[model samples]
Target: MAYNCIVLVKQVPDTANISGKTMKDDGTVNRAALPAIFNPEDLNALEMALRVREQHGGQVTVLTMGPPRAAEVLREALYRGADRVILLSDRKFAGSDTLATSYALKCAVERTGDYDLVFCGRQAIDGDTAQVGPQVAEKLGLPQITYAESIQALQGSEIVVQRAFPLGKETVKCTVPCLLTVVSSANRPRPPSARRMIAYKLAATSLECPALLKQWPEFETAEALDRYLAERDQKIPVWTAADIGADEEKLGLPGSPTKVLKIDYVVLETSESRQVPATPEGASGLVRELIQDHIV
Candidate 1:
């Protein structure tokens, strides 16, 4: 049976290179000062979902919650083989913590119904909470498999997967229509295909359509979009929040419950030491000293 899959991805600031100045005095991220990139583990999740589509005949839809600029990742997903991409962006979605974020995502997922499975990264590198997937599953009232290392088998409406545990690994089976949080080890995400990238380079999201129309009044109707898409070899479908019937209150910042309280910078001090080489007998004596010091 063909299984429809939805993958959730995120664009996050590169936190590894973060500095004190990266955070504002209000404890919010200085987004202007940071470069955005797709979350690493989320890419793995998308790869796993894409593999499912490859093995079983189905469409893979990618979803993300971010600003309008985040549409860049959706196009990137299309270039990487996603059948459809939806951008859940609104000014109200700003300053969302994990709880609010999941709520909005759950709404988006419901709007894109008819999927048998949902995949998400274990955690966002910037947030590092690892709570959105499970929270989304809870909101949707679906079975969840967290920290999935690999999908062993998918047959009919049942799926068998290997999950990673602290002490050891365990294989678990679950019914279809489940949510899964995947680790970076799940699979290697494929690089963007050159042809697809070139085709979709100027693709526009629904939010961007108006601006495009304002700039180029020549292409105004569905036919115009179709002709443009054909000539450009791109997929450009505009979907509004009204089309998705998303609740306005449950979508933006007002629907979210978590808030960033503070940002702190930490510094560490270390001492440096040098080791001296020793002759054979001196080495033996050093070994004896190490054994006595429990350092052997």
Candidate 2:
């Protein structure tokens, strides 16, 4: 049987490439110093969804909730064979913690509807809570399998997956209309297709289409440019909180209970370090010194 799948993806700060004034005294990340990239585990989730589509004959729809500039990841998804892409963007959705974020995502998923499966990364590096996917499942009233390493089998309405744990792994059976949180070990995500990359390099979301036309003027009207984009299947829909029917009270900062109390950086000083010989007397003396300094 053919199945429709939704893959939840995110564009996260490339922590590895972070540079220039990367930290503050309060311990908050300097987001401006980091370049954004597709979240690593989310790519695994996308790969899992695409693999399912290849096995069952279905389409993979990719969705992300972020600012309009996040369309960069959507275009990347298109290049990676996402049949449909949606961006949930709005200024009001800013400063959302996991609760608010999941609420918005649940609403967006409900708006899109008709999915046999939903896939998401186990956790986002920035948050590292691993809470969003399960929270979304609870909101949607669906069963969720987290830390899934692989989909073992699929039979009509039922599916089986292997969950990975720190020490070992276990298998699980669940019904469809369920969610799976993909782990990095799940599978290596495929690279974006070169042909699709070339074709969709200019793909634009609703917010970007008008500017593209204004900058190039090859298309006279928004309608004409939209038609042009539609013809090539390069138009990505951008939706606001209202578009997904999210309650204003339950979105953005208003819905978030968790607040960053402070950010701190711990610095170790090599100048404060002392070398001790690997001898009984040296170890005993070190311990004595530690005891004397009340550092034991």
Candidate 3:
């Protein structure tokens, strides 16, 4: 029997290139200032799902919840090996904390029909709380294995995974229909297929049709373009909160209980840096300085 898998992925702001405008006064990230890229760890999760499909003969569906621009990641997934990609984009999902985000994801997962495995990255860089995946598991009432480093084996109705802990490693066996929060150590994700990339380059979600039409200009209407893309199975799905049967009260900021009381932006200066000659004494001095500064 084929084991169907669903991979939850995200497109996050490239925090490494953060600028002065990266944070707004409201304490939320000003994503407009940063280029978006596929979340690194989520790519590991996707690779794990694809590997499972390759081994067990099943389909991999990728799902993400973000704005219309988030379809870029969905298209990237198609260029990889995902059989289907769905975008959960609705205005109501804005400003959602981990609790609210997991709630929406739980509903989306339920809507995707039956699946033998669910995969998610351990955490998103923008919010390194590492809460969403396990929260999703709790919301779905599914057993979860987090910090998963690698899949060990799959027995009848069960799966074994090697996971990492603070000081050691562990191998856990979980039943099917379970969620696995993968870490970056799981596997090296495959690059996009050149053939699939060419085939799916024009894939677009309905909300993206207007921009596509502007770029292509061959299509007279967005609806016509949508139909054309859909015919070729290149149209990424866009689902709203109502589409997934999510309660409005539990959908977004309203459902998010975590409040950001304050956000302080710190700017490092050259004076903060200390240098010493490259020697054993220098290393000892550095360790002493770290200890004195309470940074070690």
Candidate 4:
């Protein structure tokens, strides 16, 4: 039996390079100040889905909700063996908290037809809430497994997975047509195929060239480019809230209850320093002091 899978991915600002300029006064990320890359754990999620497809004879579809330029990640997905890709983009999606974002994703997933599995990273690096996947599953009324470290087995409609925890790990068995929030430790993702990269280099979402042609004169007409891309079966489909039949009030900011009012950058500094002996007695004394001070 062949399984159908969807891998949810995100293109996130590289927080590792975060600086004072990373945030704006409006409590939003200054995306232009940071390089964007595929969310690390989402790659693991995709790799897991691909492995399932390889083992069971299935197709893998990768989907991401982001700006027009996010098509870069979609092309990257195609180069790495995804059977197809979708770009969920619109201005209304901007500034969405997890609730609204997941609602939109739920709508998109519903349109994708029935699937054996849906894979998402444990969290996006930007938000790190780890809520979107579960929220999407809730909206779809499907069972979900989060913090999935690895897949253990798959037989018929049931699948086993190793779930990671701080103490240790636990194994879980869930039926198919379920969702999983994948962790980076799940598997080492495969690199892009050079051949696929070369062949799919021209693949792009419909709005990509139009947005580019305005800024960079190197781009051709969106229509011509899309037509040319059609020949190679490489034109990516873009979806909007309306296209997916999402409720207007539940599509973006209005549907989101969580709002960031402000952002404060925290920095740690030593107010004072004290030397402690490396001996056991000295460590015991320090622990005693910490306990007395309630700083332990």
Candidate 5:
């Protein structure tokens, strides 16, 4: 049997470094100040799905929900060996929390049709809610396994996976058509293949406008684009909300029930003191002062 796997991924803002100017007065993230990268754990999930396809003859499709710029990650996925890629981008999807996000993703999955397995990262850096996978599974009525570290075995329609728990790990066997959330320990993502990079450098997805073709006459016709995409066999196919039969109300911001109540700046108190020494005695004195001031 030919297995089909779908991997859900996301692009998240780098939250480690936050500047005073990074937030708008309205409390929304100042996206301009933050660099965007694929959620690191999601790449681990993608690696796991790719390994499954390598072991079992099957195709791997990558799906992501983000803005038009999110297509960059889809291209990156192609370079990593995904057979196909889909971008679920729509204005309505903006400001959606996990609940609304999952709804949109489930609709996209339904539109994709036939698939035996679905994979997603344990959590996103931006939200860290880790609710989308389970929510999608609930919507699709599929069995869900979260925090999976590895695939212990796969026999026919049943798959044995090593799932990570707070206390330890457990192996669970589930049938096909199941959803799995993978932790970073699941697998290490491979670097993009040099050969594929050169070939699919300009592959077009549906999210791309016809204007791109006009701007670059080389990909003017579908036939020309096809030839170019075939050269590397690493191009990601794009899809629109309509292509996926997504419910208008259930997509984008209008369909979302969650809202960002408030955003505020957190400032930490600082002191100007010169350390007398770098020795343990100096450290002890600093610790004493911190304890006295309740700043430790």
Candidate 6:
């Protein structure tokens, strides 16, 4: 019984390298100011999907929504063993909150035909809301298992998984055709294969034609380069809002209800310090002072 799996991935701004210029005055991410990298937990999700393919015999298709440059993540997925990669990109998808983002993703998932499983990261570093995966599941009307640590069994239509919790781990059993939001602790993502990398290095989306032309100046036009890539099955599919039949009103800024009224960066600095003695009485005194100051 082979399953058809789809993994949703993202290329997010490297939050570890964030600076003052990371956020714009409008409270939106200044993506141009930071380097973009594959989301960490999404890699875990991808690894899980790859494992499913290896074990149960299935195809792993990767999908992502972002600017045209987001196709880089899809290429990385190919190098890591994904069978198919698609990019959901358009200007209309800009400024989407989790709600709108999930809506668009739900549409894209539907476009991918039948699938027995969907995998997603627990959250994206840039937003950290941890809402998109569950939201997508809800929209797709599928059972969702979040914070999955590992898969224990997949027999017939039932799947058993271990989930991580603050207190401990819990085992959950759900039927097939469900969605899973994977945690980083699930499994270590495998490094890209050198052979796969060499095979897919030339794979690119139509949006990347301009940059490709710069490297291969022999191409008389971007169309010619696109033709060459297409001929070799290297052109990644770029889907627009209309391509996926997404509702315009339910996408982008118009669909987003959350508004950021302010953006502030908080920095903690010790302006003054007091040294308390290690003795019990000294500790008691410090506790009393903290209580009086309402610090605890």
Clash statistics: count for each candidate: 2, 3, 0, 0, 3, 0
Those runs of model 1 whose alpha carbons end farther than 4 Å from true positions after fitting are: 19-33, 206-243, 264-296
TM-score of each: 0.77, 0.85, 0.87, 0.84, 0.83, 0.87
Off by over 4 Å in 6: 19-33, 265-296
Q: How well does candidate 1 match the true structure in TM-score terms?
A: 0.77
How many angstroms is residue 36 displaced in model 5 relative to the true structure, after the best TM-score fit? 1.0
Give the per-residue lDDT of model 2 (tens digit) for 77-118: 889989999999998899999999999999999999799999
Q: Candidate 1: how large is its RMSD?
A: 5.8
Could you report the Cα RMSD, in angstroms, for every candidate shown? 5.8, 4.7, 4.5, 5.0, 4.0, 4.8
lDDT value, candidate 1, whole model = 0.83
Residue pairs with colliding backbones in model 4 are: none
lDDT of 5 by residue, 112-230 (tens): 77999999999989879999999999999999999999999887899999998779999999998899999988777999998878767776564464545677786667656655655
**What's the ranking of the predictions by lDDT, best on top?**
6, 3, 2, 4, 5, 1
Can you write out model 6's per-residue Cα lDDT over 1-296, one digit (the tens) per residue?
Answer: 89899999999889988766787766666878888999999999999999999999989999999998899999999999999999999999999999999999999999999899999999999889999999999999999999998999997899999999778998999999999999999999999999999999899999999888999999989999999999999989999999999999999999888877887655446789888999999999999998999999
Candidate closest to the true structure, highest lDDT? 6
Q: What is the lDDT of residue 73 in candidate 2?
A: 89
In candidate 5, which residue pairs get closer than 3 Å at backbone N, Cα or C atoms, i.e. clash?
A: 92-252, 92-253, 93-252
lDDT pick, better of 3 and 6:
6
Cα lDDT, all candidates: 0.83, 0.90, 0.91, 0.88, 0.83, 0.94
Error of 5 at 280 (Å): 7.2
Report the number of backbone clashes for model 2: 3
lDDT of 4 by residue, 211-257 (tens): 64675555467777668668778789999888888887886788889
